[model samples]
Target: MTLRLSVISASVLLALTTHSIAFADDSAFEVIEVTGHHEGSYSSVSTDSSTPQVDISGLLEQLPGAAVNGNGPLTGIAQYRGLYGDRVNTQVNGVTLASAGPNAMDTPLSYASLVNSERLEMTRGIAPVSAGTDTIGGSVKVIESQASFDEISGKVAAQYQDNGQRSHLGAKTNIANQDHALLVYGDLLKGSENTTSGSGNEIAPTTYDKNIFGGQYRFNLGDSGNESIAIGYQHLETTEAGTPALPMDIDFIRSDRVKLEGIHALSSWELNWHLAYSDAKHGMDNFSQRMKMPSMNARYNNADSASFDGAISVGKDTWLFGIDSQLSQHNSVISDPTMAMFNVDNFNDVQDDTYSAFAQWQQDINQWNWQLGARVKHYMTDAGEVSHSMAEMMPAIKMLMTQFNNADRTQSQTGVDLVLNGRYQVNSELSWIFGLARKQASASYQQRYLWVPMQSTGGLADGRTYVGQMDLELETAYQLELGADFSSDKLTISPRVFLHRIDDYIQGVPATDPAVKMAAMMMGDDNPMQFANVDAELFGMDLAAAYQLNDSWSLDMNASYVSGERRDIEDNLYRISPPKVILGVNYKSNNWLARVEGLGVSAQDKVSKTQFEQRTAGYGLMNISVAYDADSWMLKAGVNNLFDTEYEDHLAGYNRVMGGDLSPGERMPGTGMNAWLSGEYRF
Candidate 1:
């Protein structure tokens, strides 16, 4: 039955492409121009009348050197270049978002709902300190849709995809009469059976449901000033969602979020204030979503966070300053309901706080534009007290716990970051870009306070248990970037390359201490590791180009390559993305559009022996899409992985879920060929 469906979808895609080619004409089609400060750094603005109401990670994948690491439909993590997780700073409507999971099951970007957003932007290279604190990798921002008008206007949309059996519906409306305006929006999304892999096998336990609603009001004070206040709320629930990379399966996850924002404009100065809060409760077990073990193990975690930020700006050659603060608390417990005696407190009353102040200056002189920024941040963490159920039965484990509790449980650090960027327009069709930055990032809570050996090291999913380092030093990075942009009437191209030198890079190294090694072996574990500092270097390049083929057709291509190695050790960095290229052709008419694309990924042979990283073979995929417009309505259809070729991504994590055909250490398979149809009506 699946084969028949795949064949039918392939035939339909081919027929649509043939029809589109025959209908091509000399009529000129509009092309969106890409804007950027350098070759590796660019910005994209959405022009669609209504947002897709999908996960933000999927949208980010359209950019060069960007990919998504999938654990489940709602647990996608964004990867850029060779870095991910907290290394990348993500924000929504200029406000920072915090992750609510110890293993990062809910990434920062996962909270951003597309229904209320206008555009998404990313800075690929070393981001300026003003972008955010601790942005050693890059920065991503989601701009919310604002309400403005002398009249009333609104839009509503709905969509469905068969691959995940997902459905989304949303609506937004604004009412204004010169002096005052109000905007309101809402979204509903649900999905099931999201585990059908490319090999016709179910991955088990991938389903989710979510709802979000918000509103904003604006008041005009004068020609040069205005004030606005906004409020938003979101709730999400998931059932039997599997994280094959992690040790446990998610039986349920409940999350709630609330946000409040205020903005005031006065002459040449603007003032912005934001406040947000989130609470998440998650549960996992060894039996519900996977095979039952001899001794049932169940875990529960609760996390809550609050953030506040305020900024002020003035002048076209803007000078801006801001202060941001965040506080997070987490607690985790493990138990076997079947056997009440097996219960422990894995993490108890863990608290983390971050406070930062930043300043930025932007000015243009002649043909040169320059930006300089600086930031100072402070971090503090406290793990009140912790204990385990087995500590009483094991002398070595009990001794370790006593030492951990007696040590300094409270730790703090301070760091600074600086950035300088310049762009010189040599002529009308060409520009030169250069950037230099010195950035610093403190270790994550899990890296510094995991009192015991566990698989919670930023979700590496390498099947190795790791212990935290309480005295680990902060990581400092120095980066240099150079690139250029060129454009003509019928062609446009941008290319950039960058080099990064890192000091005190934190990574897991094999444990050498006799006591620690003995304890790990006694606990039925092998190859135990501990976090330590090391030196590393990374360099990469990104290229993007587009060419118009006559008036009705266009060709677009992009390629990315990156390499990373430990300078102080004889091994490569773990889980670096392989070289990749994407090529696409498009045909457009007054009311119809068609596109076909091919993506290629090179084999990854630069594996990290120390981390036991696996090498993956290269793979390619074909995809086709078509869209049509009729007055107030629009239709879009697409077929991805058209050939149903089974392949595994190099960055994919291991399959830890039990009762699967694949082993625990094998890589997860990619999705199979799937077709989807969607329609939207503007009213």
Candidate 2:
């Protein structure tokens, strides 16, 4: 039942299914239609690799430095490149997802399944301005199938994991005829999991149950290909047995989203417009027992947002513009035996609005391709809060409390991005590319409405609150990149290097209190402190290559290295980024494919003064996967962490009390040896 054992079994199952496959003559590296572009064009080229077929969530887990929070599938939030929450942007069918709070558990786009997607695109760093300006990490855009000739097209898949005694089943169908199209997808999953780590002793057996469902409809407007409307809905529910660090007695979530978009192409220019609305509610039951006081709490969160986007293109140059807005509200009331006399009730609401405009020019000269682009964006946030004493509502103990006050806050900022890129052919064997970008980050909601926890004396004490000073400046970054694409008859390789400089960083400071000591220990510099014009820099490189040694055999490799540091005199800094490397190889034949991958992370000497920081020793992990294609059917199986190696991902953040040691649920624990078997049929 161990995670390691499950991974091993999965590897064996994959090896048994694969046979041999012949290599095709088609180019492995070719430009394909991608949705990362706001204009919906194929002119943009990206280095992201795609699997033969995969779920949307599964595909995201494969990104470098990414991790999943939940035990099973489809229910967890994705932490990409060490960034989580609002730091990453997600757009589905031209609809953006933003939350009211910074908590990762309340992410907006958690879906039931993605089987009906026509295509999906992942772009890092440089995303389209229409996608919004908050994406400092990257962006993910999904394109669903809106038009189809078939009356119905669908598929079913299932997988079982031995380590956790887990099972998953998912299905999706698309029905289309004439002017209408309907697509539906759903998944059911259950898993009982155990961990193996330093905190394994404290780690308890966890069980997972989940269900997700979604549907979409499309209506056509004439045959001009310029007019159409679509609407979609997504819902998911999940329950976890909880962990030692944070126990969850109950959890439930429901969401609904709809979108409408239209396109018009005239002789002189092309026009496109989209509108979207979403509503979501997250309910949770949590029990926190620290020291003598045990607090049982239930919270209900409601969120809704809307957006509008449009673009106009003329000749080789085009200008695009859009507006994005969101509203979020949260309410929580706790029942505590020790703090019953204090009586606490918490409530807050926030709204964010953004507007942006961008221009792109694409020109082809001789054998070289050139691109130039610039985007300008303005961001604003409004927030307010209301608090009341439980005694005031209850008949038992009536206590006078401060009346609700308008804790109103307002902030505004403007930033711009400039990009320049070009590609040149040196010969049949080599091609060169160069790209440079300058990005600026506007003031976020957190930077303006600063709140620090007050020492406990009663329900509500004079909490230290400070209005954001206008002295704050926008953060900025300048980056330079160079890369090469090389290929021979049998082998293709690509390597790239990037350098970045960032300034005007903000960090939090801690308050002096005995009760908050434990909380402060885990907080590090994450507390809402002061903002300073600090400087930081990072440089990294990555390479990917594949070679066909013979007709039925081939090899593949991928690796990345990153190093970063913050130069601030006020305080010793934390490692915002760590050096990481991933190397993988594969062998494939007609009915069989096998792969081995290695993940390695270097030591991070960066540490904070109040925290006991130990440099994570470099560790490597191995994984393998394989599949077989049969007559009108295909069977796929795989094992992650083939070696059952105990290693920690460098991108992990801290929450556990154990110092420096890897916790069972701290990072994405590398499963020992797990196997999965899935069957697919094609018509």
Alpha carbon lDDT of each predicted model:
0.70, 0.47
Candidate 1, residue 374: Cα displacement in angstroms equals 1.1
Q: Candidate 1 on 1-683: residue-level lDDT in tens?
A: 23323333442243223222111122111122357542235544352422233576666655666666666566767777777777778887676655656677766776666667766677856687767777897887777777674658776767777767878887888898777778888877776665467788766555666666767676665664366666666666656666767777666666767677767765667777777777777776666666765653555444434434444333233677778777777776777766677765566777778888888887778998888889899988888677877888877667777878999988899999999888898999998888999899888878887777777666677878787878889899999988877776766676778898999988889987665666687756678888899998988776666766666787766667778889998899988877776666787778887778777777777878888988887788998877887787788777788998788877767777666666667887776777766676665
Clashing pairs in 1: none
Top candidate when judged by TM-score against the true structure = 1
Per-model clash counts, in order, read 0, 22
Q: Residue-wise lDDT of candidate 2 within 1-683, one digit each (tens)?
A: 23323333333233223211112231121112211133222112112122322225444444433333342232344444433344556666656654322233434344425444544455543444444455554566666555443367776766666655667677777788767878777777766664343223322333456677777776766574345666666665655533222322224455565566665655556566666565555443333211112232333323222333333333324444344454333333333444445434332454556666677765657876666777787776665653435444542222111212333356677888777766677887787767777777755444443232211111000111112322357767777767776666765665567776777754333433332332233323223223235666656554445556576555544444444556555334443334444444555566665556665555455544422333444556665666666555566666655666665433333322222234423543434555556555543
Where does candidate 1 stray beyond 4 Å? 1-33, 37-41, 45-54, 149-151, 176-180, 217-225, 295-316
**Candidate 2: deviation at residue 240, Å?**
3.5
- Candidate 1 achieves a global lDDT of 0.70
